[model samples]
Target: MKRCFLWTLTLLVSVVLVVPTQAQEEKFIKRKVAIGRFTNETQYAKGLFYDKENDPMQKQAMDILSSKLAASGKFILLERDDLDVLMAEAGENMQKIGADYIILGSITEFGRKTEGQQKVFSSTKTQTVEAGVSIRLVEASTGLIIYSDEAKGFAETTTKQSLGLGGAAGFDATLSDKAISSALGQLVENIIDKCVDKPWRSYVLSIDDGTYIISGGASQGIAASDSFVVYAKGKTVTNPQTGIKIELPGKKIGTVTVLQTLGDTPETEISLCSYEGEPLDSNKLSNYYISDK
Candidate 1:
């Protein structure tokens, strides 16, 4: 009886020493994103004499892409345009935008060509417009270019049996818009696919005793009992070709549990627990990150 009791106590101690693995969480994880100002590279300034200030082609494309990304339920759209104001007014403490990635876009091609003009006998005129954009999704913490893709779309409109009414037609003016929208659609899809394949990450905005504030809630498909692996983010490495910095993979420090999901605002404060190997250091919360387990 004494030997059996000792063996049972040993098994119990071993079980207590082992940390339980967290079950797999959400089926789909959402990442936070910020859209940056995009540049227009088309050759309209030197020759075409089109007004670019009021309705810039690059701004138009940016708006389209932003709208599409916002409509897609895959991302948490954060505002990057007001970064300067936020820093100046709220200071660095308010600098945490809860964004995981940032998007930079450029309009590489934006032009319209009108060919086969109406002649004495030939009353058919064809107008073709093409718009192309290159997009880069950068990991905000490391500035790594996680995904890069370029898509071009073309729109053609032909006016037949016209009596020199091409000038009054709307095809020339609207073709560019149509083409831009089409290209942006493809870019949005590319972003979604890449993001889906990647494991999502969240940040520890602040810590309150045993509770840690994070940036995911019901909107991101997170809920109570969800588990995460805590890590410390490392220095960002630069991509030599593109000169974009990418965050290096972090070292696992500890684990956290979702004690409760914050109200309807897509924010939550979770509870921290000792990691499997080394106990998590509270002081090294700087550059700390969280990934779903």
Candidate 2:
């Protein structure tokens, strides 16, 4: 019986060690991001056959970046390409849902080259494609560019023929897609790091019977009993030299505790929070925001 008891105790200890506690779990808060514009500025693929509004190269780069961001599962990507249609369809509510940051990018450089080597009994041919992309992360609220970066990608394919018996090589159109995808792949991680550099933030949406309805919910990592600090919007000042407007530091006003969550999707999710500390002016809630810190 004593041996069985010891075995049971060991099993219990193992279970406890294997099961992770709630506090030990990793926490990730999703931020809303929008790709404002991605354009092909390169000379490649531009001719009488090129369509400015529907450039294939530009579309491919945007799709690659969008796919990368989506796969990370760290951001709620807003659709900016059809934003005008959405605004017209959704009306006023669409305006409330805004991206925290906007990404404007361009394919600055793109080119292809072919090389060949001839020998007595054998010959080889190579096709190479290279692409360069530049991106700027802009703060939506302040209309300021916070980060800018560039990345390059290269791809090549080689074919060999023995006495002209092997298959001949032609233009490898897929290389363009591969090169662009590689370049954007290098930039995706840096873009994520820049977006999450600061604390996750949300704003008050409304107040119903003293319960505060705030802008994020389960999809954004806001859970019941989660605490957040509310801050008043900082004062904005215009720089005389650059003629740029800058916002000063904001003051901490109060705190809020998440009571419950609402909505089915990240874009529509909202949190019900109970206010504490300093009194908030309901009419001026737009001037305030809540942060994890």
Best by TM-score: 2
Predicted candidate 1 versus true structure: per-residue lDDT over 1-293, tens digit per residue = 99999999999988776645333422677777777657787776445566654446777787788788878878877756664454355432432544666677888887888876556754766799888889988665544577999999999987666554444434567777889999889888888887777777776666676567766777777776677888877777778998755667788877777777664554333333323434445566567878875
| lDDT, each prediction | 0.70, 0.84
Residues 1-293 of candidate 2 have per-residue lDDT tens digits of 99999999999998888778655775667888878568899878688888888999989998888899989988888766675454356443333437777788999999999999999999999999999999998766666788899999999999999977996888788999999999998889989998888677788988889999998888677799988899998998999999988879789988999999999877788999999878888888888888877
| Cα TM-score of candidate 2 | 0.85
In candidate 2, where is summed lDDT lowest over 10 consecutive residues? 88-97
Model 2, residue pairs in steric clash: none
Alpha carbon lDDT at 199, candidate 1: 74
* Worst ten in a row by lDDT for model 1: 267-276
Q: Estimate each model's TM-score.
A: 0.70, 0.85
What is the lDDT for 103 in model 1? 79
